[model samples]
Target chain A: MEILGYITLTIFVGAMVLMLFRKLNFPVQTVLVVVSLICLVLGAVFRFFSEGWVGVILLPNEMIGGIILHPITALLAGLFLAGALTASGGFDVLKVLINKLQKTPIGLAGTLVILIQLPVIASLPCGRIIAAALLPLLFAFGFEGGMGLLTRSQLIVLIGAFARNAFGSCGPSPIGGVGQIGEGFLGAFFPTASEGMLRAPQAFSLMLGTALTALFLKLITMKLYPEGVSLRDLPEGSVIEKKKAEAKGSFKGYLSLVIFVAALLISIFQPFGKMPVQTILVAGGILMLFMCRVSIRDLMSGIILLPVTAMASGFMAAGALASTGGFEALGNILKGFSSVPFLGVAGMLAIFVQIQTILPLACSRILTAALVPVLYFFGPAKFDLITWPQLAIVMAAYMINATTSCGPSPLGGGGMMAEGTMRADTGYIKGAFTFSSMAIMAPLAAIYMKFLTLSSFSASGVQLGRDVWLIIEFTLVIFVANAIIIKLSSKVLSEDVDKNWLSQLPAFVIPGAMGGAILAFCLYEMAFLRIIQGAIGGIIASLLIALMVPKRLTPAETGE
Target chain B: MDCGTTEWLTFLFLMAFYLSVEIYQVLRRKEGEIISFAGPDIPLGDLLGTRANVRMKDGEVVDAEMSGCTLCLGRFEVGDRVYVCKNRDKYVVSLPLFMKGRRKRSDFCKSSCRREQASIQGL
Candidate 1:
């Protein structure tokens, strides 16, 4: 069984690498399905050599058992609601409201800041829906769109930050979110784990990470690679072009939006008891059809098949691996790393939690489904390397890293949508995306999980009262350190591609070291040596991530 | 974070602490006001953008013949699903044209507007 697991793991890793490279031109989900069959066949063959035909029969059931339905239904429901919103003019209503909001004390940039946070607040299952819906409106704020409300820089920052938040929103979504995958694993210990045990930590880290992303875009991306950005600055001495008003919303738009919000609230709070989230979302969609006058055809049009297919197929492959004992073999292999003197158990966990971000996938669901169970095995009940509470902390960090991994993926990722809107080169914003996730969000999430999320939500009631100050201190340190890095980098940042690459060396290492050490400390409490191991682990991870960022600008970028 | 609770307050605190400071610094330096345009709707009825064509500088808001829906004014990221409405009798763009077979008209608008439309159906 263990030998088969290693073979299955090899096949899985090779298939994922193949999917990441676009040279084959096959769809990712299709590749996942093919890999599942290969793993199953190998598993069946191994079983035949050992236990004959009877052992092979149960492999199919084990593979089938891996399919998780919660996120799939939630994704479908989210699309339905989004479709209704578009059909019923709910988005127009939001635009009108946002425009009005700009006049309030928050001012334009402040209003835009809140606007960037909307996807996370809405907690949509997919980022593209809201990104698609709002990105044009963000463009409308720019000179090209003729609103002339925001400069090219502000527009880039606004769209980029919003995209950053939107892509990661799925990590904390209670309704059919990818976080539910981890929550299900955690539920074995914490009874209330499903009640968004990971929400606040992800949300907290993401908010800060997003702000740093905006800063990085403004300071580093725009300055270092002006040629990379395609949005033209206002012509010299040209007066800003006159613009026009936005479309108005009707009563039905308001009512429909209200329904969407109500459905989200009900799903999150579960006010009527622990009904399946599908029931709440589908019920909301049905009510919108009747009350909001949205057509069923329009609702049907909203359901995107790609993400759903990606998730379902990913589950099938993961199930195949589990049935083949692939997870056990993978865990053993990873645990073996702890034997190295410099890479203790804490260091291994730090590296493990961050591996998804280190090698991002197009949709986080692909790797997350396969890896979280392996992470589950690291807990006290299985390997005894970490307690349940420590596992929760690592889960928060891992899940956020996984959710945001898609943002930097060059393979048709969610961040690509934002890049298209910005008209920048394909990999222009990747460095910022990778840096923010690795250096800021991961450690911030770990600390939040330990201090706040676990303190309140854990079933065993671990009181982490004394270290609450760490949260405040860590938040301030990350914010200040990242700000100074961007500020100093801004000094040497210019259009020279090679020079810009040279400039990023320090930016990647410093915060990454702090991030890793902080992550280790959060997990190990007072173990100084473990903390050093974590810093070494952080430095190594940061170097790999930094290397992956494109060193050369594309021809179009250089042309501009 | 929950609404109106300490957790919610904490969320707002973090948001205010980070976002407000960052945004205000940049925004306070930015040189513009809130400009509004036809709320992502292809301008219709009394509000057509016959002179406000959202294309290249040399192009007029509407084509010479002024055929079909003349409300063609919007922007989008490249390669996205675009709303392909007619401008000057000829289709002058090349992106993934998204003509939802069931929609009321064949005329397209901006990719973002169309992407927003398709985002409902596509994503």
Candidate 2:
């Protein structure tokens, strides 16, 4: 018979990663396939035998299958989107905008920060882009400014850390979805408990607040120690080399963007309602090849990278872990929070969690599911029916949203990006973002708990218990409001020389469209309701976005 | 009488060799002075123990790039002056000279340039 234990063990060895960094050695996509195949085989055995080893290993088949499909589909879709963006020079357009912002020391610093952070908004969780772009700038700066070797290293590391945190915190991003689940779970358990007991909005707020707080602290640190620095200016001889490429007018650029976006949308969502994400992505990739006149060789070169594959694997592994009780094990560990006073718990936990040591790809899924149900089961008293589970679910979802990393967790992509871009050691900045965010979560949780506690049975706030719709709506509103703040800050920063570089970057439609497509596919497959409609809606949204974005100015126009 | 004659001969030969050495240096200095040969190179002296500027003929500037410097690549830029050390292989340039925390600019120039210009000038 199919042995469930065998299935779970296969995933455990392949999918569920330990805190050690060794697993980053393999590409995530390959690992996912290997582990997934093992699970499938065991699942088959369980189906046939219906006893013994196979049954013990196999989890709920539908959930596991759904999880397996999520990242695989998303990756294929993202590959097309990224490829199209690259082919059309859309990525270059964004880069030029950032490069132009480096008119002064402050502007340069700001640009560095923004570049490192931008990917977080789209939920691409690595900093290789940041590292590649910023390292050269720092090198150029060193050449011109005459900075000492020590100072240059310091700048790269510090800027990288800050940028990582900024990206992870961008908007009411879906990357935070897992946390949303956790909040729903936790709020159910602690309604009417004090604002201190709640974890979601409070912890999330704290994460944002603490990141800003660290920035201030960092500024103070730089001020106290004065150092000599120098940088090299580009030789007059080099200017001739840069002017060879003639830019097509802004119209051509915009048209290219439209094409890329259209392609992305069609691939992600079934505008016609029946296509798979992989099929769409492959088609989009092919279309980009034809439009750009790029060879198949060039397309492959752009598509392959360690980070992309790793992300796919990480997602698959996390899903497998969730299916096989890995999440439950983690949740059991966190159950210690129940014994602590709700008010002090979040703040205290934030300081202690050694985030850098734990690879975020492994941690996000386990933590989310583990916390969700527990929070929901223990929730509060309602007016008429006194249904505990429903109350618990609402309360838990809200609180958990704040405290957990889910997608935006500093330990994940954002953290890695910051470390690589800034040229700082990976864990250095992650520590600051994580600890400080944790501090914010503690107070926020308390406030949430307090509101729940004093809320009357007949009050509008109290009705939130049964109103799943309200919970989702309020959470979304809060998330969007925060995202707006982040975007506005980014815009203002573009003009300032000393701000983070990533903030001032113009948006790239192709990649953005690609992200939209993959996200849509993931949601559709998971929701399993009107998947085609979701896909179609996604495509339309991408096209609209492509059409609306303003054409980016070239580097020459910016006097770079 | 024999001892005195031998000592005098030895002294005369030593003086002759020293004179030829001085003459050779004078000719070299004269040749180097021609603009075509690259006009008199100036040694700015070492600004720090390991840093200096040497103004080569035609005003070519070179900075030291050091090994194992905190900067991943050795390059230092201090304002318009870039101090690159080819021998050190690390680039660290500091501006305005004063912030360099060195005792004197001339000291750095001397140690870094290593009296190359002085030798060229026949100093």
Candidate 3:
């Protein structure tokens, strides 16, 4: 039975990889669906051999219902919202805003930082929509005075910015795709824990880690491509010359943006009992469609562009794995390592990180779903050392690491879009970005977990000991190892390194303010009203900044 | 049951096998040489042969003639160096554009071409 489970699991993973790489030369959705069907058949056959025909019949539906439906519904709703936003020309407003920020090097740097931070602020269906929208603008920076090649520094900055946003978006927001998936799985495994207990600390930790990573990458970009010599300072060329004048500001676009923001805020605050995020998003999307006068045909077309079918199939595959006792087999295997002295936990974490890095897209949600159950089954009572909350912290860290690491995979969602946009060597970017992110994020996640655990204990008046200290020590060792690995890898990967100091002031100010607002909400137990007031203050400040910029005249009005 | 010696051996063997395969893949990859061409000197169509499907701006499929590269339609002269994909089967890019300090060959001729393909495919 164990062997059969392992075989089924292997088949699923193998098929996913082969399909993802297009080694089979078939449509990815078709491949995923076909593989899922095969797994179901194998699972049924195994069940028949082990139990009976009744077992075979009942298990598949139960698995699908229990594991797949909730996440799939949430994902589909998020995709629908993204579709509606695109159709309503909300993305065009974003493009216009990005273009407006390109007047100076400082402005361009600030815009890049803003683009990195947007996903956390406004959670979308994965980072694909944002990547598809913003990456072209980054690509536009590659051309200047007929010199079209992107400098190494420019490429690194663009890739890093996109990667940070793509990875960080999901773990920070409960409404985000990975967030929904993680929270759903965590809720199922640890039903007693409050949603805030599980999600809030994790979200805060991930946000802080991501913010620091983004700032570091931004600084590196600035140093390498100094303000004076940066791509923005290059001579004006055909790319800029061909830039279309911004369309007249439409009330529909503004109204759509407002509606979307309002819906997100309401969902977050939930003044009236726990309303489903999907319900709010769907309502907001419909309102936007009505305001923008968008047709159903256009909306459908936009939705079809998203990877909804692929993600659904991924969920099904994960469900099938869970049903077949494959997760149990996996846990049994890892249980051996856990028994080893000192290195046991570190070994397990290393393996998880490696797996996450290697098979990012599929593992992003699937691994989290599979592992949480294993943790619940084997934790505290079985291990007798680590508490449930400690296990939860580890799960949170894994979720952040797994989902975010997918952003740099050349064959995965955000990375594929970025490769298409940049038309550059993605192999180097994949390696460099993944390693660099891991080096920072792994330790940062550990530290955040420590902070969360310690703070909670302090508040509750409890004593903690050697186990927590051991984990921290292990994390520091891993961090040092990662730094060494990065240093060695850099020798071979070879990026241009230079030094300059010109602070991207606007870049720092906005993310800092946003972070401060969220932290205040978290620490002081501030009301949603306070958060709303801060948001309104931000909007006014933005309006004032907009007022200062010289507006471009319409082509007809200018007699072009 | 506790994880026995057999299970441990199987796990170690599997890990070693996976590691070896990954190492082999990295080592086995062929690195393409960057060569120069100028003024219609490089026969990109001939070199690419049936691998490339050239298309025009209006979504028309064109012949893979010695006119220029399908993506940019920029005529290459002798002494103009260009990068080509080491593993040509892996990428849609036939003749890669020139890039400084580029180690791995790009999968597209230009950024616009890649973007156009993505937009059309709705990727």
Candidate 4:
């Protein structure tokens, strides 16, 4: 079973890599299907050899069980509401309302920050819904979109940062978020885990990561690969007339917007008792159609099948792996590494947490679903590699890393929407996104959980006052180290293959190693050997990760 | 058939819904807004020298100017770029007349435009 699991994992990863490098030419959905089917056949073969006919018949039970329908249904419900909003001119009303926010005393940068983080703050079930709503608004700040509020460089940062926040917002969302998967697993031990065990750490890390991503976009992506950026700065002292002269919306538009807000409030507050969110959203969508004169076609067209289908396919592959004990095998293999002198348990955990971030897919849920179970197995209930409190810290790191991985994915990532609007070639902002996830967000999440979040649970031998300072100190160091590396790398780097690797890889690896070690220490370890092993483990993971970072810097390097 | 009732229902619902959308789209397909090309009937009424998002015959919307005001064949054509200012409730486009076939530009959009330089920034 272990060997079969190993084979399945290898084949799954190999197929994805083949697709990613363009060695295999197929759509992302097709690629995933191929990977899943391959894993299934492999699982059946292994089962047949091990336990004859009975095992083969039971193979699909575990495999099929991996497909969780809650999120898919939730996604469809969210899309339905989004479509109705679009059809009824609720979006237009929103545009006007958001447009008016420009006059607030908070000023441009402050207003921009609020708008960038709004998706996460709202805690929508799907980030795409809010992203679709407000991305046009973000673009309007650009020269191409005709508002001219920001320079081209500034526009790139704003859009990129907003995308970073938007794509990861679902991680902390109360409404059928990907983080709920981790929370569900954690509920086995922690009584209050399901109430949102992973939310604070993810939210905290994502907020800071979003800010760093903005800096990275401005300092690195735009300057490093100017050709990828299709936007131009305006001439000095030129006047750009506003694109929408009136910025007015109709009565129906306003009515739909009101209902939209009402829907959000109802879902969040659950005003009418604990009805399923899908029910609320679908009801809201139906009301929108009637009041706003929206056709069913308009509602249906708003649905994007790509991410949903990708996740389902990912589930298929994961199911095959799980049915064959692939995750168990994977855990044993990593545990086997504890015997290796250079990489101990801490180091192995570091690499494990950062792996999904390094090889990001279209949806965070894909890898998160596969790996969180294995990470849970590492706790005292299983291999005893880490305690429950320690597990919480690691889980926090893993959850944030998993959630934000989508920001850097080349395979139909949500960030691609921002890239399209910005007119940058694909993979333009990938470096900033991956580097921050690996170095800044992962360690930051771990430290935050260790100090504050896990305090409610009986995490022994920790002082509040000391831990608070340590959190601040660690965050500053990680933030400064990463920011310096990015800023310096940007100065020398170009978007081409050779130029991109020249400094970027080393920068990523060094910080990734540091981040891994930091996470190990945050697991409440003061030992020298564990820390060194953690750093070494981090280095190995970072190397694989650094190599995986996209090499396309220029428009000429657009296609795989 | 292999999955649960929810999955079956979801699958069926999506198929029917999308099929209907496709049918609706095909049924409702129509041409772009057909302005009268400013013929004698309309007489280019206050549309001259104004920067309007005019759809070309190819259906590409461009910041366009009316070719003639007086002699008035009265159709919109794409130009180097357009600058516009408010004219009562309308916006009149100010473009450098293409007297000698387009005043020289800087090769391509340097990612900057006159439209992005103004103070109004978001939304």
Best by TM-score: 1
Candidate 4: stretches off by over 4 Å: A236-239, A242-246, A269-277, A286-293, A412-424, A457-470, A487-500, A549-552, A555-560, B1-123
Give stretches of model 2 more than 4 Å off: A1-63, A66-68, A101-117, A120-127, A130-158, A161-287, A304-424, A427-430, A440-560, B1-123
DockQ of prediction 3: 0.03
Error of 4 at A165 (Å): 1.8
Model 1: which docking level applies? incorrect
CAPRI classification of candidate 3 = incorrect
Candidate 3, residue A321: Cα displacement in angstroms equals 1.9
DockQ list for all candidates: 0.03, 0.01, 0.03, 0.03
How is the predicted docking of candidate 4 categorized under the CAPRI scheme? incorrect
Per-residue lDDT over A210-239 for candidate 4, one digit per residue giving the tens place of the 0 to 100 score? 989888877776665554544557767778
Report residue A189 deviation for candidate 3 (angstroms).
7.1
Q: State each candidate's clash count.
A: 10, 141, 9, 9
Residue B117, candidate 3: Cα error in Å is 18
Interface RMSD of 2: 28.9
Q: What is candidate 1's lDDT per residue for A1-560, written digit by digit as tens?
A: 78899999999888766645433333456667778999999999999989999999988998999887656666656655666676677878887788788789989877898889988887777765666566546767777677787776777777778878887887887766888888888889898887888888998999999999988988887776664444555677888755743747799988988988999998888897666566567677668778888754444333333455567777888898899999888889888988778987777877777787777766788788878888888997678788888899999999898998876665541122222322122266677888889888999999898888877884555546565787888899888988998899889877667777878978998887878888889888888999998888788788777766765433223344
Q: Tell me the lDDT of model 2 at A539.
A: 34
Q: Where does model 1 exceed 4 Å of error?
A: A413-425, A459-468, A555-560, B1-123
Q: By descending TM-score, how would the candidates be arranged? A: 1, 4, 3, 2
Tens-digit lDDT track for model 2 on A1-560?
A: 22354446545544434312233322233445566556555555555565565555555453354343333333334444454555455555554555566565757567655544454333322222233323333333332233322233344343434343333331122222223333333343445332222323333443444444344324322221111111123344543223212223343334445565575456434586644434444455556556666543333333323322333344445555445444444344344432344212221122112121122332333333323333332323211111443343224223332323322232221122221211111222332333233222322332333334324322445654644454344334433443444345434543332343333122212222222222223222244333333233323332332222112111112345
